[model samples]
Target: MEFSELLEQAGGAGLFQTLLLLTFILPCFMISFHVLLENFSASVPGHRCWTQLLDNGSVVPANITPEALLTISIPPGPNWEPDQCRRFRQPQWQLVDPNATTSSWNEADTEPCVDGWVYDRSTFTSTIVMKWDLVCSSQGLKPLSQSIFMSGILVGSFIWGLLSHRLGRKPMLSWSCLQTAVAGTGTTFAPTLLIYCGLRFVTAFGIAGIFLSALGLMVEWTTTSRRAVTLTVLACSSSAGQAALGGVAFALRDWQTLQLAVSVPFFAIFLISWWLPESARWLIIKGKPDQALQELRKVARINGHKEAKNLTIEVLMSSMEEEVASAKEPQSGLDLFRVPMLRKRSCPALVTSFSLLISLYGLVFDLQSLGRDIFLLQVLFGAMDILGRATTVLLLSFLGRRTILAGFQVMAGLCILANTLVPPDLQTLRVVLAVLGKGCFGISLTCLTIYRAELFPTTVRLVVLFFLPETRGLPLPDTVQDLESQKSTAAQGNRQEAVAVESTWF
Candidate 1:
């Protein structure tokens, strides 16, 4: 008998699985907050060089409006808006006159702002740009900071991704929760740009660990029957968090407070994570049938199984003996590229992930270019993600993952490409196309994540859904050999037909 059969007797899709799925929502929410925080925190607002009254040491008349004063001190940019970076070397008082039509100010001596900048605080009270004077020559630093955060994720992905196999998902996950809580909260107190970026990097590192461990634990614990819908619900919760962030940022307006608001809640989440069980599959594979037995019995009891007390280490070992024997030696990430079939699948999966992320993030970071209220746009984007991912729940039930992934990939690319061809005068059409493209893109990403999860062995599987669980209700495969030989274990007993239908597609 396979582990799934044992799991069924122990109460598959029971109370334990349901609670574990629900527990995942908050961490996903927190992840969304930190991942997208740059939208509000680093946003650039309307700004111009700070203009001072003439060197005569005379105070300007109080009646003179700031806008009028700006016209005299700052030249118009290419679009005839007040220039952001340059200011008049000497004030051209004539430019303030409504009747003054001369373009002579264009040739007048100009220099970069010597003083600071005057920011428009109508939307954001303060952002990184306003805080660190990151406009003009310093503008590159903003993107650089975001890059630093992403780089941390990249590094952590490799680190935690490997460690989760050896150290166990729950332990790494607990450490990650604590790490994110500490580092993310510490970001609120950073007195310098360097310090802020450093803290953000560390927070992102923890975020990677959280994502891998949390998702791994969720998948490992859940029966295949509920995996698709369970993941959809998790994705929906994350999108909800993203939508909520728009309102939160709008209300708070201040960057530090917004950062603090999102980070502090993880402490509670961290504490709650302690109560979660380790992946029983991982334990059995690691030669700890005793611990696995205890966990299974615990799950059976919590799931209200009357036979819970009957589960012994002997039963647990017998059930997963094949799985345990196959995992006698640990697998490494290199095995993905070293083994033949794994190499074939790994290359394409890696490429697809890289491409999808570049496009998705490109669209996300360029939200301001849509020329709408940033807060509303954030909500709209989040809503689209929810709509797209929610559709997957029904789609995964019928369509094969490859078909959905390929179709959405083509659809997303077409919509985004077509968007660029549309004239700028058609603002509404542009926004519609942008939103539709993003929605399709979100769907494609969801497909890729689930698809990738089905392709590898247990060692790396915990990191990326490697060869553990197949699509639908297949039992978790413990080795590369098991993965290659996988058939619908969902065909056991009376539920065979429904599960066969679920697992039939690639």
Candidate 2:
């Protein structure tokens, strides 16, 4: 019997399963927390070049106020304050006194700041930008750090996917959680930008592992009836974490403090993760049915199944062997891409993910530039994200997967186009349209995950989905022809939503 059948026989959806779901969802929430926190923690605030106000590059008279000295010593821009990177070569001391009328300040010849910039620190006292003086010549470092963290996630997905198969899910998850706790919390203490970036990358790998293992365990334990609903709800739960991250960031404006707050939770979660059960199906597939049966009996006892005590390993092994036998021997990882249909779907999915991530993050991380209040806007972002996913789930109940995915994608595209065409002066309109576009992107992505799963359960072995329960049941295809033959019924009892965010946070 399939594990789903076993779960059904043992009482499919009940208190035991509910607790298991909640346990796994904790890691999922933390994963989302890591994804969105990068925005606030790395934010660069308003700044201008710090300069000495004098004919030579020497300090101005002590009587001068910072703003008055800046008026004479910095080159002004038509909008927003003085030039961010440049300052006047010589001081116009008249501007320092309130009684003197400043004249021809725009004509002063300017040079780049010889010293570092003075930051507007009211909102953020410490951030990635300030920590390393990542402005002007070094501005790329901030975004580069973001990309490096993402690269670590992608690398971790492939590496940990293999390790999970070798070391088993539970051990790898525990170790990864330890890695996250240590590396993530250690990031706050990093003395240099290089060290901090490295720690961030390490933290991402741990986040990826928690994401994969927790998701794998939950789906494996549930029956088919609960699996689809479970996946959808699990995804929405991440939005809750994103929302909470905004609140946390709002409360603790210091980047180091925020980093410590988010990072410490992983260590606590690692302690709690001991309560998670190992996947019995994974044990059986790995030719350890005796161990699988032992775990299953524990689950059975939790569900109040008395016969579970009488169940023997040999009986369970015999049942599992039949299903394993019908499937072709597990093919190479290349098999996921070898088939024509799989490649066709896989290519666009990657392109869509890359483009979607760029657009989504670009918009979100630049949110401070928008005229809206940053804190409220972040809260709005979380609310919109939750609403978007919830709307997708609601629509799925009524519309065909393809129709819904196509419709949402098209609408998202249109919203982006509209936002692009809006005139520059209308900041309010721009913010409104930007939020609308982001909301559409959120919904489209949420639907794409559901659509892809329902569309081709056998094709996508994306790293995030590698440990997914749905992948477990797909009888490995021996040839491209085998994939074409099975495509018809491939949708049966399959459901996983865009966990690609775990790595797409690749």
User: With candidate 2 superimposed using the best TM-score fit, by how many Å does residue 496's alpha carbon deviate from the native?
Assistant: 21
Please give the range of 10 consecutive residues that has the lowest summed lDDT in model 1. Answer: 497-506
Q: Please state the error at residue 25 of candidate 1 in Å.
A: 0.8
Model 1: per-residue Cα lDDT over 292-338, one tens digit each: 88888888989998776777888888877877877776567888888
What lDDT does each candidate get? 0.81, 0.68
TM-score of model 1 relative to the true fold?
Answer: 0.92
In model 1, residue pairs whose N, Cα or C atoms come closer than 3 Å (at least 3 residues apart or on different chains), thus clashing, are 453-465, 456-466, 456-467, 457-467, 461-466
Regions of candidate 1 where Cα sits further than 4 Å from its true position:
54-58, 62-67, 96-103, 106-108, 463-473, 487-506
Clashing residue pairs in all predictions, respectively, total 5, 1
Against the correct fold, how does model 2 do in TM-score? Answer: 0.84
Model 2 agreement with the true structure over 1-506: per-residue lDDT tens digits: 34555555555666678787777677777777677676888888888877655333455576766677668777666684687888877776656566764455555467787887888888888887988889888888988888888888888878776677556778888988999999989999999999998998999988778766765666567664455456666677776677788788889989999998888888878888887777776677667777877787778778877656555777666656654453336644565567566666566666666776677777777776776367677777767777887776566555554566556666767777887888877888888877787777777677655434433322123242221222222333323444454454445533342122121110
